[model samples]
Target: MEVAAKPAIRGAASIVRALEAHGVRYVFSIPGVHTLSLYRALDDSAVIQTVLPRHEQGAGYMADGYARVSEGVGVAVTITGPGVTNILTPIAQAFADSSRVFLIATNLERPFLNRLEGNLHELTDQLAVVRPVVKWAYRAMTADELAPAIAEGFRQLWTGRPRPVYLEVPLDLLDEATALAVEPATPPPPSEPAPHLIEHAAQLLRNAKRVLVFAGGGAVSRRVAPLLKEFVEAIGAVVLTSLMGKGALPEDHPQVAGAFGYRWSPDNPVVTLMERSDLTIVIGSGLGVRTTANGTMPLPTPLIHIDIDEHEFGKRYQPDVALAADAAVTLSALLAAVHAGARPREGWTPEEIAPVKHALRTPPDERTARYVPYLEAVRAALPREAIIVNDMTMLCYEGVRFLPVYEPRSYLFPRGFGTLGSSLPTAIGAKLARPDVPVVSLNGDGGFQFTLEELGVLAHYRFPVIVVIFNDSTHTAVKVAMHRAYPGHYRDVDLVNPDYVKLAAAYGLTAVRVASPSELEVTLRHAVEANEPMVIDVPIALERYA
Candidate 1:
C-alpha cells in the first residue's frame, strides 16, 4: 500500500488551524487585498464562523461584544494599514473594558516592509499602532514563529490581566509551506494572593465593625461572580458594583448597594456608606478616575485593594493593603480565610442597607426622571434573561444609573473608553454569540450616526435585535455641557436626522414610532414574540418608541 500524502498547508492555513485548536467559534472580519489567503483558509474551516461587518470598526466592536458575552475569546481579522487604523478605537475600547479580543492583521511583504517604497497597504510599523492599547503586540517574522506567537497571544489574553492582543502577519509569510500541528497550549492558572496577605485581609474583614466590598468589571466573570456572592454573604458586607461590574452580583440582591452606586459623587448615599465603613475590599477594580467620580470620591480605610495588576494599586486611589492577584483566586482564598473556624460578623444589616439603597434608588434626578418611563418600558418588554447594550448618550447615562441588572453578562456599556455609537454593532455580535438570548440596542440619534451603516449589517443578517433610537436631533450630552459653560449660546450642535422609520423600511426592517411608554412596551413585546429585526424611533421631546 502506498503511504498517504499530507494535505497542502500554508502559513495562513496554519493560523486557521491554530484558531481551531484554541476552540474559537467566531471571527469578525472584513475582506481586503492582503488578507485574502487568511479568508480563504477561514472559508475552508468548518468549525469557525466568519462574520463580515460593514466597517473595520464594526468588526472590532463586534469582536468586543462577542468576547463580553461568550466564554471564549473573540477574534477579528483585517488587512494592513487602513484596516489596522480603522480598528484602533474598538481595540482601545476593548482594552479599556478588559475584554479579550484577538486581532489578526496582515502587513506588507517582508522584503518591502520598511523600504519606504510606498508598498501597497504599507504602514511603517503596524505593531506600534496597537501597542498602547493591546496587552501584547507582535510581528511574526517567519512561518515557524506564527504558532508560537499565537499561543503566547492567547496566553496573555486569557490569563493574568485579560485585554486585547494584536498579531501582525507579513504577507510574504503566507507563501511559505508548513505542516505545523499547532495544538492549543494550556493557559496558566489564575494567581492567588500570599497566605500571609489573605490571612491579614481576613483579619481586617473579621475585626471591622463595617465592611464594604467595591467590585468592578474584573469581578464579572463566571468564575468570579459566585465567589463574590459567597464572600459578600459570608462577611455580611455591603456590596457596590461599578458600572462595568453591573450584574456581577444581582442588583436585586439586598446586599448589592446599587449599580454605579457611589461611583459618581461625594454626597451620594453609596459614598456615605463608603465613608463610614471601617474596612473596604476593592476587587478586580482599579478605581479609575471616571468610576471614582474623577477622583472626587474618597478612599475609605483601612483599604485592601485586590487586583491582577499591581500597577493599578496606587494609580487612582491609595490602598493600605495591595494584593496583586486574580479576582477569582484572591476572592476564593479570602473567603476561605474568613470562614476559617470562627464565623465573621455581619457588617451591615438589611435594615441598614435598605435605607441607603432606597435613597440611591429614590428621588430620580431630572435626567433620570426623563428616562424612567422609557426604561421601564424596555424592562417590562424584555425578559429578565435579555441583554442590553447602551451607547454613550444622555439616555444611556441614566439607563446605566437606574437599570436593574440581575444576571452576570446581562448588561453592557462602553464604560472605560466611553465611546459613542458602540451599542448597535456590539449588540449584533452579542446576538450572534448568544442567539437564544434576546438583545436590545439603545442609542441616541446623535451617537447612533457614528456607526449608522452597521444597521445594514443587522438587516442583512436579521439578527432579531430591537434598535431604539432616542432622537433629540442633537448631541444632548455635549449640548447640556455647553449650556453649563456658555449659558444661552450654542454652535453647530444641532443636526438634521434622517426619518428613522423610512430608513428602517429601506433596510427591509420593521419600523415604528411610539409616543407613549405603554405603546413601546406593547410594540416591543410583539417584536420579541415575532422574533424579527426592528427599529423603534422615539423622539426625545415626545419620549415615545415602538
Candidate 2:
C-alpha cells in the first residue's frame, strides 16, 4: 500500500516496495557497500524477511532451494562484480534445473559500467556474465526504471519456461530517490494445447500396445502431477521418472517406477521397458544428459513430447507429436482425446512392473550395495513428507534411484547441473520456506566443503536441518573414475581432513559421529527429536564404499 501511497521514495526503497508487491517473502542476501542502500530499506520493511548468507554463491543456492520447495520465485541480492560472478554457479544450476530464482545485484555507476575501470567491485559487463544462464538479464539506468525492470523480471520468471532472472541496479540508482513501486506482473496465460497435436498423440497411443510414460522434473509441478496420474492410469501405462522427475508419481504406486530408467545399460529394467514399448509419452522433461545417462538411454519411436518451451521439441529426438504448451493443459487435453477413442491397450503388466521396482531396490553391484542401505536408513528414519535436499555425492547418487519419494516438491537436488556444495544452503532455504516440515540434506565431505561455511548461517538463524555427511576423505566419484581410467594415478581426488564433530560443535550445532547405519539412524532420530541444526559424520573409506 505504501508503494503507491507515497509520492516518491528512494531507488532502494522503491525496489523493496516493488518486491513486496510481487509477493517476495524472503531475500537471501549478503550485504555489501554497493548494495547497502537496499539493505537499509530491507531493515525498515515489516513484511519481508531477509536472510544473511556467508557467501554470494550460498545465497544464490538458498534462493534456488527456496524457489523449488516453495513452488514460487526465490530472490537473492548481492553487491556488484564478484557478487554477480560468485553467483554464476547457482544461476547455471538453476538454469539447468529450471528453478525460478530471481537474482538482484548492484553494478558500477553508469559512467563506469561497461568501461574497463579499476573501481572496487566493478565489472566491465555484469549483465553479460550472467546473461547466458538467466532467462533475462537487465540493468536499470534510472531510479524510475526500477519498478518496470522488476515487473519484467517476474514476467519472465512466471510466463514461459521457468529459469533464473537477473536484474542489476546501478550503485547510483540505489541512492537516487524515486516514488516508484513495482506493479504486479500480468502475464498472459499459457496457450491451450493444440487440437491436432493432442489428436495425433491419442491416435498413436490408441493404435499401439504396451505404452510407456517417461516423465521428468517439469512433470512434478502441483498443476501437472494429478493430471499426469490420471492420464497414465487412464492409458494403463507404466510410469518411469527421470532423476528430476522422481516424485511426480509416488514411488510406491503400483505403476510408478522410480529413476531406475536413468541408466541405459542393456539389463536396465526401464531401458528394457522403453525398448519393448510401442509408444512413449514424455512430459515436462528436456531429456538432458543426466536424465538420459549421457544419451546411453533410448526412447522408442512414435513418441509424444509435451513441454512449455518449443525449443525443446526437437533438441534431442524429434517427437511424432509435439505439444509445446503448459504440461497440465496438455495432459488434460490428451486425457480427453485418449478417452474419446477409448481403446483397450496392453501396457506393461503388474508382473513386468514388479521386477522393475525390484531392480531399483536391489543393489545390482557391490558399489551400489555400499550406499543403498544408507538411503534405506534415511527413508526408514524420516517420514515420506520430510524434504530431502541433496548434494553431488556418492550416497545421493544412489538416492536418485534407491530413495523412495512419495510427493512432488518433497525432494530437491541439483540433478540437472550436478553442482557441488549446494545441499547445505539449499536445505536452509527449504527449511526456511517450509518451517513446519522436517528438512534433511546428504552431502559428501568433498562437496560439503564448498559451502560448509553456510552452517554458521543455519546455526545463527536456528534453522533445524538434519545434515548427514558421508565423509570418505576423497571425492569418491572422481577418484573411482580416475582409478578406473588411469589405474593407480588418482591425483587431487584425496582430500585433507577436518574433525567434523569438533568443527560442527563450533558452529552451535549438535554434532555427532555415527559408527554404523544403526548408529546413524539412532542419532538421526535424536537429532529430529531435538529439533535443532545438527551435523552427523559417517567416516568410511572410499576404497570400501565406492
In terms of lDDT, the best-performing candidate is 2
Give me candidate 2's TM-score against the actual structure: 0.96
Candidate 1 residue runs with Cα over 4 Å from true position: 1-8, 261-263, 341-346, 542-546
Per-residue lDDT over 1-546 for candidate 2, one digit per residue giving the tens place of the 0 to 100 score: 554466768999989988999998999988888888898999989989999999999999999999998989999998888888998999899998999999999998888888876789877677888899998998899999998899999999988889999998989998887866568788668667888777777789778888888888889988888898888778788888888887898898888877773354657766677877888789988876556665556787788898888888776777899888889888888878777874437777678888878876788887678777777888888878788998988888778888899989988988777799999999988988788878998999999999989988978888999899999899998988887888778789889979998998898778999888888888888887888898999997635523
Clashing pairs in 1: none
Q: Local error of candidate 1 at 56, Å? A: 0.4
Per-residue CA lDDT of model 1 for 1-546, tens digit only, reads 996766657998889989899988889998988988888888899999888889999999999999998856889998989999999999999999889999999989888886679677777777787799999999999887888789888998878788999899999887778766696879887787888987778777767878888888888878888899998888888888888888788887988887754248766777778877888888888888778876677656888998888888888777878899988888888877877832345578877888888877764566457677888888889888898999998767776656778778888899888898999999988888789988999999988999988888878888898899999898887777778888777778789999999999999989999888788899889888988889999887632221
Q: Rate the local accuracy (lDDT) of all candidates.
A: 0.84, 0.85
lDDT of 1 at 167: 91
What CA RMSD would candidate 2 show? 2.4
For each candidate, give its TM-score against the true structure. Answer: 0.95, 0.96
